[model samples]
Target chain A: MERTPVLRSEWLKIRTLRSLPGALLALFAATVAFSALAGVSEASDPGFDPLFASLSGVIPGQIAAVSFGAMAVSSEFHQGALRLSLAAVPRRGRWFAAKAAVIAAPALLVGLGAALAALLAARAGLGRAAGGLSTGEQVRGVVGCGLYLMLMALFAAGIAALLRSGVATLSLLVPFILVVSFVIGDATGTLADFLPDKAGQLVLRETYDGTLGPWSGLAVTALWTAAALLAGAWRLCRRDA
Target chain B: MTSIDVRDLTKEFGGRRAVDRLTFRVHPGRVTGFLGPNGAGKSTTMRLVLGLDRPTAGSATIGGRPYPALREPLRHVGALLDAQAAHGSRTARDHLRVLAASNRIPDRRVDEVLQETGLASVARRRVRTYSLGMRQRLGIAAALLGDPEVVMLDEPSNGLDPEGIVWIRTLLRRLAGEGRTVLVSSHLMNETASFADHLVVLGRGRLLADTPVRDFIHARVRPRVRIRTTDPVALTSVLARHGHDAQEHADGHWTVDGARLDDIGRVACAAGLPLLELAAEEGTLEQAYFDLTGAETEFTAQHQEA
Candidate 1:
């Protein structure tokens, strides 16, 4: 069958889900709120990077992003919905690709809008401290923040598919992004730069002193997302719905 | 028109075969009841036919093509594997809408099915709030959304009221009347007898009987004679001497298998026994089904022990 109708069906599923839109709303609000707070309080720190601080609200907001991805895939596993979906489409690969496309598009759009709002909100508090940021730095931070959030959402979605349980995906990811990346990140030194969350966040930094540059950091995160998605696709195809 | 053809289909889970080289064809313009006991693999066979699970051996096709090979499969074959398969958070209308959109079916067909299934009033309600019978209606609405040539439902009459059951029976007959192939699965023989024209019976992952409903009963059912006499001992002796398989009931009635009512009465008259009552008993579809599946179960048990 042609792919357009299947994609349209998937898009309808996402839009009709009340919790999904709520999660996106939470993503936007959390990102903007936390960035404003970081700008006000963290601006006094001697080592503060203005670009990173302005976009730092994504640190907390990305939780909602992860949830959006995980829930979208997990709902299909609930109540034998996957059986109905596959029966209608019959081609598991095509249905899965359509699902991925719907998830990616919404996450990317909302992530970009949220990042731009966070940067402006935080810059309001940073005042003179944020003045050192050049236009190029600000643009990179905004764009990188959006892409980073979208990647994290996809990363969570892929893991959810692999695990076949949204609760498990959230349980594994929320902790890894919150505790491992934040607490163990410093102790691991350069190794932490390759972790999905840390690597992606590096793109938001104005200047980095690591083996990876900004774009390469996002590329590493993309690699992690790709691996997770591949594993999910394999499991979906191999198992009986 | 699409017809389901399953050839040597086998499915094994963890070394235990669920469907053992089962083969059957469901033709159009009639209701084919997929009959089996629990775990007899009726659902598994349906899943294989729909390409939901890969068969361990052989193939299942619809209209000369595998299920996955069909473009817009919903328009080719519509199936309801589980009544509760839809997401609870979505409204019944949206559930059907999602399925219709997948096959490029017209949006109005969704409303038509809901109306046909008598769920138009509750179409906007979330499925979580629906009763089991209501959920069944929603499932049926989904199956009919594309107006497909082939429709398959598994245990669809479960949790339905008597009226709902009758509704499904009429719906199945109407679909078959339209020259569409319909396959419905259930463990209850009497229920299937009410609506199905042909039956495909399974026992212990194996095919037990495949024939028309009337022929199934005629072939599997054994007619017997129920006799009551004034002198029990003399009549029993006479019946025993005549080589009849007669068993005494708790209510003082004797049922003689493989015996004619007239012959039993004549023999009793010649033996000088006064017959109080003598009548022929006709076997029903329920009894016939029990006889076939019950014997198969015993044979399977002994075969396994061997």
Candidate 2:
């Protein structure tokens, strides 16, 4: 079979995988649930930006995205899966490319839907405050948040493939996103804005004072993802199954 | 045709050689048993053949080309390196379908193999829920889904019941009888003796013997004529004068080689000795195998029993 069958098989692997699809579902649920909570909660500070508040659910939702990416590849590391996979598609490049595509496509689709859900749910709770957000900002925020989550997911997948362990990837990333990015991100000031998660999240805000602009920040995040993906491809090509 | 060939194939992990300059050819239309003790490079050699591991030196090819060169390798060879290598969460049917889809095998072939392997009843159940025997069947089902010309299995009989073992023994014979090359690896002597047409015996990453099973048994096993007599001392002296080395054990049985049972009985009769029992000990593949590999193995039958 040509590349089509490999891709189809990988798609089937992802779809049938209970944990991976479960992770995607968790992504949708977590993001929407958090955004709904953000909408209902009263903002204590005067610096409350409704746009950021509406999309705040992305903070927790992106964990599921990263998990999805990492788990998709990490599953191969368990139960001698890589051996069986390589037996079917002997060419390593073909198998790795197909796996990456399977991970990216679903993540992007679900990311968009989750982003839309977060905005709608959060907007309902912040009705009057969300009124001031322009149409262009909402569109940018939605599209950017979707793309941002997808990038984070792809980044995690590349890392997972290189390490061949989802546990390692999640352990490193989950804390970095939730803890290190805030505590260390504050201490580092402008330099911290270029970090993959930090830089990519810039578009989530309606107004930004970061060193990099929204598209440029996304470009930086994409560059990080590209670098990670190349490293993953290299590892996949060189390592034994 | 040499459907599966390993030419001076060598693999080393860190500083230790896992497979050392192994060379063998498995021809089509026969089942070659890959026999070895634990850690004797059986799995490593199979991995090299399938390109799951890079050989440190030399080459392993299937149908005359390295595995990576095949556009879709499954169409040429199907391998099951491990029975439980599959994800536990996927159903048996889904597992076969995933492999089938990768090879462009028809969806119907999935069901066919499931039925053939007797897994149709639990096709929808998760693989984790299946017993070890069921997993082996599922692995065999995946290997057969592509309808490949060559099937290579490692320890396929490990978890099988008597009926399942019989099923696989027949399946292997039928597969080879259909002109496909079937290479099965197992350490069990009697199990392979039942169905293997040829034997490739390995020990400590080296080939110990490679020949037709019957030929190996004939060449390595020593057939003996056992004699039990009332007057053992008289018979022993008579056999010794007849140029036969008859050794009498403490159990009062005399074993003699290089002569027929008739000749031994004639010698006893010539000595006016009454024989209580006279018989010939037939050589078995297990006996032959141990005689061939006893020194090369780290442990012996005594060790295994202990």
Q: Which candidate is the best by DockQ?
A: 1
Tens-place lDDT digits, model 1, residues B56-127:
998999999999999898888888888888888899999888888999998899999999999999999999
Whole-model lDDT, model 2: 0.88
lDDT of 1: 0.89
Minimum summed lDDT over a 10-residue window in model 2 chain B is located at: B297-306
Model 1 segments more than 4 A misplaced:
B295-306
lDDT of 2 by residue, A39-139 (tens): 99997668787888888888999999999999999989987789999889988888888998998888888888888889999999888889989999998
**Cα RMSD (Å) per model?**
2.7, 2.2
Question: Residue by residue across A69-109, what tens digits does model 1's lDDT show?
Answer: 99999999887788999999888888888988998888888
Best of the candidates, TM-score? 1
